[model samples]
Target: MASSKPKPDPLSIQRGDYARTLAGPLLLGLGRMVSIPLQHWLLTAHPLSHFGIPRPPSDGVLELPLVGAQPQLSTIFLGMTATLILKQNAWIWGYCAERITVPFAFFGVVVPAMYECLSALVFSYASSNPLWRKEFLYVGAAVHFFAAAVELGSELARARFKGRIENRGRLYKGGAWGLVRHPNYAANVVYGAAYGFAAGGPVYALFTGAFYWSNLTGNATPAKENYLAERYPEEWEQYKKDVPWKMFLGIF
Candidate 1:
């Protein structure tokens, strides 16, 4: 018999996802203690969440996949279909940006939005504790859904006026842009943290917050800055003064 190729070391296999490797099991064991109490404390602080706690999101937004679809879909069946299609459309267009929208509209506007949506799902599902139906599964789903909605909404806001305006590809300063420099990105961080909550360990949230935020901000911000300078130089410079939140870290 031919000799079998050597198996990859488990450690090496997981090196890229260090949080899942070194810290996942530990978080799994501690997810309940960390997620439940913190959730209670945080949600109870909000009148709406506290009131809704007993009823269990009658909208069943958690079960829904679009995660970001407007609750306005009205009918139950149509709503679900719309959400899935919308999300899938975003995934397809964003993924295929390389082929469409020249000079800038495609990649910068789409890729970051799509990556975060995927991350939301990953974070939500990965952190979820199958045993805790509501806490991990349902809750995790809700968090990611909200996360996707926020980013998509931001992207939509950014792209909406683009086609109508003379300079469709120009950097903007309105809607979410009105809220902060990167309100969408800031929301991504929040959703990512929520994914960690579902994952069960506060540690997961910390690692994601610290590492991913830093890297994405560094990469995207510079590119965006460059794009703004190249496309809307003066307006882009002023856009900074009006909205200075970096990852909504402080300026949300």
Candidate 2:
């Protein structure tokens, strides 16, 4: 019988290869920049109005004064952009993984770009509705900002813990980790839904929330748990007992 290869220790994975770290964020930023102009055109110019695209109300809440060539920004737009900027910086600086794989990076870029573009489209489509409230936009923006802060803070806490020499090979169980096994994942869902809500409304918010919840729970969270189990067999089991929740407390 042939000998099986030994599984590499998870702790051996290095952090932050410049090329891999930078590539994902740069690509994401490019995609976002492109989406901005597209969003502006969709909202203002209504270039696709002939193709069943309903024109936004000339005096709609979405219609703000233009600043030079660009449409005047809204709270929703600012929240979305700020979230992306925060995430990009986190990936470049705070993420502990050394090499972000090409497929994952591409997935990250494509998913967010699609979400942003589609959300804008949906929002524009719904703008003519008399029931659509501007307060939803402002409230969603606040939630988005709060979610971003939580995500960043939790990730930074973990990163700082991992950076300590004495903490090498040890599991992080403090800060937000004490609250849930995956606070960052929880925050991801919040911000994603918040962005959707701010961009469109309840329908978009539910869509985004469901998408993120499913993705994280079905894929990302399980994969991470398995990795942690392998890396810290005894500690992983204990941590699960201690935390009791995977991502959201009293929910998952």
Candidate 3:
């Protein structure tokens, strides 16, 4: 009889897996670098106006005013003025304190702070009036605001979630976790793609996705699973049974 085929190793990294590990980050980074500037460059180089679009800087400088180089400006605030109602634990300090460095945490605090400021700068610089007719300051702000809120609320609930903990810092229940096991990660994918969309040009659309992908591999992957699994054994396994992966809203 022919020898039994060698069994694939469960822990071994496959060729495709390694390629994906490299490709995701590389593509995302390259996409951002290539698109954003290309859009800006396209806006600035023209002398004659196209389709009634306003003109950009004649000197060919991309101010990146979103970075706060503009004068007499302010921010756009979209926040949880209303307290997020959620279950808390005496031992967990309300879930917000534990994962202080999470992306959703930074997004909550940062996006609103910069939204109006960036929009104001983009318009002030003009670079040839709105690249797309569908673009608007309110729309972009709303998108970022919504995504940030979802991410933040979900993350907070996750921190205090009671369930499996492959690690001391991880879990499998609570908040958005009850719906989608990878709520934070799902939010990242949404907002990452939306950032380029909000930028309102093909350039950002092409590149920003790569950044999110890279970010997921580096930050969201093990932090959400393997790390916790190693720390907490029985709880995590049970949590996995209680919730499904990527179900952010609900499961029927």
Which candidate's TM-score is highest?
2
Off by over 4 Å in 3: 1-126, 129-131, 134-137, 159-172, 246-252
Q: Arrange candidates, best lDDT first.
A: 2, 1, 3
For model 3, how does the per-residue alpha-carbon lDDT over 18-55 read when each residue is reduced to its tens digit? 22333333332232233233333433443244455555
Q: How many Å off is the CA of 45 in candidate 2?
A: 2.7
- Where does candidate 2 stray beyond 4 Å? 1-33, 51-75
- Lowest summed-lDDT stretch of 10 residues in model 1? 72-81
What are the RMSD figures for all models against the true structure?
15.8, 4.5, 12.1
**Residue pairs of candidate 1 with colliding backbone atoms:** 31-200, 127-198, 127-199
* lDDT at residue 206 of model 1 (Cα atoms): 69
Give the top-scoring candidate (lDDT). Answer: 2
| Residue 236 Cα positional deviation in candidate 3, in Å, after optimal superposition | 1.6
Judge candidate 3 against the unseen true structure and give its global Cα lDDT, from 0 to 1: 0.44
For each candidate, what TM-score against the reference?
0.49, 0.80, 0.46
